[model samples]
Target: GLGPEECMAVNPRLVYGRMTGWGQSGPLAPRAGHDTNYAAVSGALWGCSPADARPVSPFAVLGDIGGGAMYLMTGLLSGIVQARATGRGTVVDAAIVDGSAHMLNLMLSARQSGLVADVRGQSIHDSAPFYDTYVCADGHYVTVGAIEPQFYTLLLQVLGLAEDPDFTGSQWDKAAWPVRRARLAALFLAQPRAHWQALLEPTDACFGVVLSPVEAAQHPHMRARDVYSERQGVLQAAPAPRFDGAAYEPGEACAPGAHTQSVMEGLGQSGARAVWRQR
Candidate 1:
């Protein structure tokens, strides 16, 4: 049964299964919008980029997957475990806004400590060019995550800039990050992604190619791990959280009325299709 227009009363396990961005019922819950809009309302999308342009769309993954459905699913599972142990079931109120706010706990701490500015892309991790993406010669991109001293050293070494005076002198000193980042950006632009990958993949330098969506599915590492599969001419995601010593299978899709008879009988309602036909 549905609850209060926005909420719904289902199995505590299933109640934990529903997903939405604005969540079941908040001030903005009834408003219809997409992930970007939903994220904006929950402080998940404020000044998320450079001050010059519109916000980038990172897809529905943030609101729908991260804040909404995934957390609900997790809560549901946890609730099931709790109920089994306590012999009591309860409802789960999964609100995307609440979840999204919870997701910002790290940043909240930073903010409270005055470490993070009230501005976006101004902090060390967000604004620091030392850990960001750069375009490559092949129209692709590469990520440089030289966040720490050792990793940054590995980056300089692999880039053949080991002999550069600034490479070792003032790394991680904040002031030098801009200069180092500029140098690294230029160096990355000079080579294709594959060239950098070949050199850095074996080293401690945390470098990687910024692959396209299609490239991710057939990537060598993903294929080696069997991270995805195809069935009945449809590409379906693999089941997550593999069972402990048990096999898992996806339920078959059934038509809407496929279980109507069974459900009605279970509910003690008398509406058998065969009996109706006899009348």
Candidate 2:
């Protein structure tokens, strides 16, 4: 971490971005941690799983990439813009514990507005029947998110539940959820995945099939979007948010000292380049 004061002494226009689990000035700043530990403190892990079960172990994306890397990049960009205007350096302390907590404010706002329940497995998106996953006869799973009244009506019509008395009431009625969910579960299990796909997939019902890692890149939409590419014999996702209607081709990871001479020349220390070449 560049202590801001020391780095700014040499270059006033520097945009030094530091990423860590805890913030630079906090009580746990010097401690080492990974995504899980950071998320635990940040409240990102709350309500991420069923109320009966512990929160599932998530990938590193929530804290390491989402909170840490993304925030660091945003901070760096803002600092660079400000430094250009003010001719002074900015030191960005982008911490996962801080940024992830900040991300939870959206949920807090939703709760305050009564859109989200204070308890788990009760909110529209958290565990509601219209927003949860269901299993098909073939043992595969599909998800639904028909939150709006119109879309929920469409979903029921497609699923052959248009005449069911349980689904006719307000969507937010807490007492009706379990009975409604039972009916939905039974209907979803009566047919194979392809059977439901033909009926519900074409509507504005917010439906999706739960795909595995190996099956994700093989989906029609994934193939159409060119979301993945092979590099050095390994298939990985292409860079996102394309410009000019295509992603920028990412280069392979360069080994250490790959650009040592060029960097030294840029620093006006070209004479030191020979020391590396001699080895």
User: Which candidate number has the best lDDT?
Assistant: 2
Q: TM-score per candidate, in order?
A: 0.77, 0.87
Which pairs of residues clash in candidate 2, taking residues 3 or more apart in a chain or in different chains? Answer: none
lDDT of 1 by residue, 1-279 (tens): 355233423343233355666666777777777767766777877646654557674654677677777778888888788778876555667777767767878987878865466776666556566677788888788877777888977787777888997666766466666677778778888988888889887787887777764576587875665555555655444567666743345455555678878877898866775764575
TM-score of model 2 (CA atoms): 0.87
In model 1, the worst 10-residue window by lDDT is 4-13
Tell me how candidate 1 scores on lDDT. 0.70
Candidate 2 lDDT over residue span 1-279, tens digit each: 348788888898999888889988878998998898888888888777777779854664688888888899999999999988999768899999988888888888888878788777877666688988889999999999998888988888887778879988888787899998888899899988878777877889889888775577787778788786666766677777798897666677566888888898999998877876785
Worst 10 residues of 2 by lDDT: 52-61
Q: Candidate 1: list runs displaced more than 4 Å.
A: 1-18, 47-52, 110-115, 243-279
